[model samples]
Target: MPEKLPVYRIPDFTPAKALSRGIHVADLQAHRQKHAFVQAPHKHDFYLLLVVRNGQGTHTIDFTLYDVKPGSVFFLTPGQVHAWDLSPETEGTLLFFTPEFYRGNREADALRQFPFFQTWQHPPVFNVQPNSLSPVEQLLHQMQQEYSRAAPFQIDALRAYLELLLIQLARLYPKTTVASEENIWPFQLYQLETLVENHYLEHLPTSFYAHALHLSPKYLNELCKQNLGKTTTDLLQERLILEAKRLLTHSPHLNIAQVAQALGFEDNSYFGRFFKKQAEITPEQFRQKR
Candidate 1:
């Protein structure tokens, strides 16, 4: 069998302190040298914010390729696959934090409130305009300093800076429809998305998630349509298709039948039909093309 895609935890990079804190910050070039394996496609259990001060190459998230240059900012949530190909001269900063660390004492789903963190809803990459780069650059520098220091309430200090950094990035995120705190739809949608993420592999029905969110199936569909331009079923199917693609692309040893079984489809033929309907190609064709 092909090796399982590596999933890294924050502690993997900073074994001493990250186990307890669930956060780590590093200078980009040194981080690249120290963890060269990161260049290979892998997943992370923690969230990642990579701010590129200067770089040249491509950062691939899921199947999308993003250009790397000065002021490029990328956000990655847990379980997403990503890899970067950067020049040796690349210099920047990387912040890795888990949802628990970012949430602290706030709402449990605090990190999901940001559009960038909603990987299903928005692309995870953006560029910082040079004119507006100072504040963001300064925030990253402050975070690095705070992370490196040995001081009282350091976690709290780091959390505060992280929150500020997220807010700053959210403001600059392009054409995002970030809802106000009082808005219920966005939070409800986020909750539904979270539920889907957890249960999609089970092939659960849309009503299952609707009931979990205390909303009727029809209203849930309406909310998804209004906000995401897709139905609840579409979200579930799209997620399945994405995972199918990932398996097809990364797990060369898994034959089509095994991939189908892995994805909760008992019938490999049915899985092939479903994939073609949603992805516009057969599993074999997709794998070969990839």
Candidate 2:
């Protein structure tokens, strides 16, 4: 049987009943004091920007452990399971906001361009240098202060500050070695990624995507390889594996075969092999491990 990971639907992001919106920022110590869920593996539906101003700890995100330090900043995406272990003396600031809160009505699709939100590949932790983090911390402090006020255009001010902070953080974020920009997608990798994201459950083939985009399969493959350093097939498989992992670990009611079929895999055995090949563990093992 698969393990049922603890799932948390924060009141701030719940849509059924109207909840207070906009940025929610507070001192980490204070937030911890009010909330008992500090060190539990759970997933939420809002963005979390954690700035560790002091002390040390370990943050477990999606089965990977990251050391937490004073100068580090962590960007956690929605639906990514994570938890934290920190000392009482640890002090910092935490900011949480919904996607609509930050972007307003602007339709902010480009937020994914940031490395941390590239969920398929990059680990969502940023260890900012002590010297370089001064500016970043300053911006976070400003945003926190602005969030406390009933001032007009408050959302505008907060959004502008958030955008600046994300841009600045991206600059300081260490580039990934495996996912380097090889040729810079001058073509349509983003479009291809969007198409895959929407239709990945259909188990569409690379040729189908190429045809939909009106490009030759060879050209699409080349574009994906140059931009993401992976062939089109690998890219699609990565998405499938990620979804399968999510369902397996988070949705324990779905058995192995059911999860495989949901991911558009026709043969359960083939799906298990493919998952183990990419994730280094069989589907059942992964579900139980989590």
TM-score of 1: 0.94
Worst 10 residues of 2 by lDDT: 12-21
Q: After superposition, how far is residue 93 of candidate 2 from its true place, in Å?
A: 1.8
Q: Write the per-residue lDDT of candidate 1 for residues 8-94, one digit (tens) a residue.
A: 988788756643457898899999899999999999988899988876899999999999998788898888888999999988888
lDDT of 2 by residue, 1-290 (tens): 13466655456332333224556777889888777665677776678888888899899887689999978889887767788999889988887777777667886466667777666556787776677788888998898788666688777888889889888888888865224576443436656766787788887779999998899999988987766678999988887887787788678788899888877778999998999999999999988887
Whole-model lDDT, model 2: 0.77
The TM-score between candidate 2 and the true structure equals 0.81
Query: Any runs in candidate 1 off by more than 4 Å, and if so which?
Result: 1-3, 18-21, 176-185
Identify the runs in model 2 with alpha carbons over 4 angstroms from their true place. 1-10, 13-19, 175-187, 211-214, 288-290
Evaluated at residue 42, the lDDT of candidate 1 is 94
- Looking at model 2, the pairs that clash are none
